[model samples]
Target chain A: MSDVFGVGVIGAGPVTQAIHLPTLARMPDRFRVTAIMDVDEPVAESVAGRVGARHSTSADDLIGDPGVDVVAVCSPHRFHAEQVEAACYAGKAAVLCEKPLALTVADAERVAQVSRETGVPVIVGAMHTFDPGWLGAKANWGDLQETVRVVNSSIVLPWNARYEDWATQILRRPPPGEPVADDALSRSVAVRDAVLGLAVHNLPHVRHFLPDVESVDWAESVDPYGYLVTIRGGGIIARLLGNMHGYWKPSWTLDAWAADQSLHVEFPPSYVQAGSSVATLTSDTQTRRFGGVEANGYEAEWLRVWELAAGIVPQGEDLQATVDDLIYAVRIADAAADLVRGEHARDRVR
Target chain B: MTEFADRPHLVTLPSGPAHRDIAAALASLPRSFRPGAGEDAIVYVTGDDDWPASVEHALSVARRAIVVIQPGYAQPSTVLRLAERAATDSVPVMIDYAFASNPAVVLAAAAWSAAVEPTGILDVTSRHAGDGTGPMAVLLDQLAALHSLVGPVRTIRQLHIDGDAHSAVVAIPVGGGVITATLLGARTELGSRGSRVRWLGPTEALELEVPHAGTAGPGYSRHVTTEGEQLAPTIYENAHRATLARLSRHLEAGAGRCDDLTTLAGHLELVPREHPSRSASQRTSDQRAN
Candidate 1:
């Protein structure tokens, strides 16, 4: 095995900076970020500088590099499927892509298909599957878990505004008559993607705790105000709670109950203090407490990729499971999209 | 002193967890009532400017009122304005150290004899509470000692003291109900005040004095069984270091601003025309000049 795999990073956004690059730097001997590819040259260059890698403005340049063995895709939602397939075609040994695997199942399936033909191991970036809290939960939960009942996950976004500070400024100052994609469908898609992008990171986590998810009969209700999801799988009904309306809820909260016991995990919002998460497990006799540990969601996921590639754990292959979970999450997303579209069509009809 | 029943409605302004804890404790009062969203008679203002008008708007009705001053942080101007407003309507005021970041407010508290409902504010500094000058940690430990002995049945209305030169007391109503243990820590400066220590005085922990039948109603007691000691040594140190670093940053910013670091208001009057030298001895003289 190569002592250090030269990894090509496909996105220079917050995820790459906050999660992927930091985790790679921590374990230098196992993986080295050799290059970065992003549509924005400056962003790619800046991220490359931070991680000490060369920059590529094009995806082809990044995947084609002889020094790059593994490709980590952190691109936008629309671009992930093509990028992943391209990296696989470029003969990269491992292609690790960020989750909500794609905007649609067709895109996710295309990437999945390319991986099947090229024989390159592809992992989605859903690191929550290996969360320390979840690990502790699994340990505390006994095997052959009796009937799984309810899984409640809530991701509250306090500052889920129309745009971030930078994006808001750009939108305000754009040149005249430039077609800005500002429509109900685009807005609804953004909302769906927020759920797909942020919420799906933890789907594998909820699934891990309740391992018998046979089918997901998901219902979604979304308006300009908020989004709420009800998903029933593995005899366990899960509620994903988030209100685009309110500003002060926790970023993520999950409660999973089996026949004899239940697990509760609360994750702090992004860029807050590390290990500031809390987890509680309650059975008939006792309740256990787990918190006061740093959280590195993005870094944790990247580390899993490195560890799996290095043979530290048996395949360290939770990403495939993540893709499967994303498919289920997309069903929720699709339901929400249909509701939103139907509402828009009704408004138009009237 | 116990003559006043729960007449002084405990109003806690929404601050961080500590303020929220105070609100929770006050809300849990058996005879306590939360004024409707638009029916706040008494309003409390703390550090954040998030919710005063909303509170004032909420208290659409009711005549009696109480306002808690955040000790050092509340401006003297703001305090006087509040005092005047309270006086205009004959509203009583119970000043709490909810605003310790501003010295002007602390000084302002000394002014209003009539407008201030309580003759003097309750100060729960470790120095006053007989705990040594270690920090809020030691004071919290002392309080925790009393907290450990209570069963699920006991609850105490506590005036919690920390090493920081601040004090806040809330009515804690615990009646065999599960108590939620919350953790709190922050960076702090090492002050020169002597500890309230003398030899250990009483075998039994102090009891919270409640004034009325309503205040002392069932399901609430002034005794809380100590939960286990939470080790926060590192957290305390981090907070202390951060505070020191912030202070140092402020000092390095410029002389006029750096003078704010001097806790005593008189010292603020003496900030010299020239920047004080880096020498600790020179800084002492600068302090003395005030």
Candidate 2:
């Protein structure tokens, strides 16, 4: 029961080198980065060297390191399930995993199963859902679930250089592979992964307002880099879309409408410490706006994860709920990719 | 095609007081303020006892566009046929939906295509705080705006409300997505009288809120986000002023009808052949017209 706990982070890439380490530095008194690991030994050693933590080329070695009290899975999306399962089985104080929460529904469920059996608190980094401003808005909205009419979300984002360059530069990252030759199945899967990557960030937030996603109406890829999806259920419909393009700045909004009341949540872009997301509610009698909670979700997320790891908070969220949220995101992605492929096939015939 | 020889005069048959408000609003304008026609821009017909007959005569004699202030379109077919005639005669027609003409509605419509393009799933909720709009007219006016956005709707499927005053969830097919409108007539405590239209796609999203007619303070057109915080002052004109201004633009642009019959046909799917049909504002127009 040491006051300062040890944190072992797997994947010493930008997220670790840039996001978590900086966030951990801000909360130095409560937690420490003990062991860092990545597939690339140089990246592991370089990032570890700066943070004063040991480096490992093997993820298991880092997870099992004696000084490590908490395990953070920040590796590629596909590795989330196994690494999270490994960390949970290792009985780390807690496990913090970045999202998609492991690509497929089955993988997500398996990871959930492991977390449950191990009784280790696991948190998915759907950061905006953790913001104080969003929590404030959620607290204020009442009876909207039953009365919501339409849910519309729009995100127009620019290049990542705005925040990416703010931290330590990783100049020697591996280049991305060429696009996989598109067969019907691979094209559909690619569309699913691509859509999920951008849109899932908000699915967790949208579910907070309307949870019943009975069926997907139509999901289409708008241009080269984004998707437009409409999901219906819970006596309401939700329209969700996000794109990465030439925005003057980041414009991301989750808007929910009801007969008398509406909720709007605006999220701050990633990798910065600007301010918390802003949420405003408008109703018949009055309109209320909330903001100035200067801590961003990225920072807030680390603090919360540290609190749970330190047994300071009641382990934040349940695995089942996280699984359902992750599954909903997957459902949206699959539905959208299926639709785009369907239209493509139909177009070929015509 | 060559342009009309002279500037078009605005012809508004004396329909009601609301009708007069519009005609007066137009007549008050000098020819220079309006396009084409000079100070002699407006002709307000006073001699006719038969309302429909006067419009027929006015349509023939008027040099340019015709204005129907709240044409109850009691027989939707009759007014639509007149619009068709106006189109054939190369005359533009403006059917003014005054409540919808507020600066907010105009500005939001102006912002739609550029800010957030719709990818099929276009949803609109038309609810009156205290049943702000009459039975079928509420659906029609809202549908008219929707037609402009989603192209022609192909079908409309209506769902029921439980023990509610008058609530129906109507889904209409347009393009790749569907336009769903939930019209609640008898719920004031739950919400105020206003219409919110939202367009959502993968790349962009937008929501526009239009308050019920005559609800706002004068000279107030401001842009606000979905959360109801004012964004900026909008370029707004009164719906009455906007309808006329739009007509002038149509005339200048050689405009005939705004939404064609095919578009109306798409809208007709939402209106049952025998829904309690009446022009909600025709009474106000009649009071003013006489």
Q: DockQ of candidate 1?
A: 0.01
The fraction of correct interface contacts reproduced by each prediction comes to 0.00, 0.09
DockQ of each: 0.01, 0.13
- Predicted structure 2: clash tally: 18
Q: A1-350 in candidate 1: lDDT tens per residue? A: 49689999987876676667667777788789899988899878877987789998988888899899889888887888888888889877687887656777677777777777876777776665656676666676675145445465655444433222232222333222222143558645654765675667566666554554443332233322234444544444455544332223333677664545556687765533255457787765777876546655555666666665565665333445556677777766776666555544553564
| Chain B alone, TM-score, model 1 | 0.30
- Under CAPRI classification, how is model 1 graded? incorrect
After the best TM-score superposition of candidate 2, give how far the Cα of residue A228 lies from its true spot, in angstroms: 0.6
Looking at model 1, residue B238 earns an lDDT score of 18
Best by TM-score: 2
Give the least accurate 10-residue stretch of model 1 chain B, judged by summed lDDT. B197-206
| lDDT for position B109 in model 2 | 55
Number of clashes in every candidate structure? 31, 18
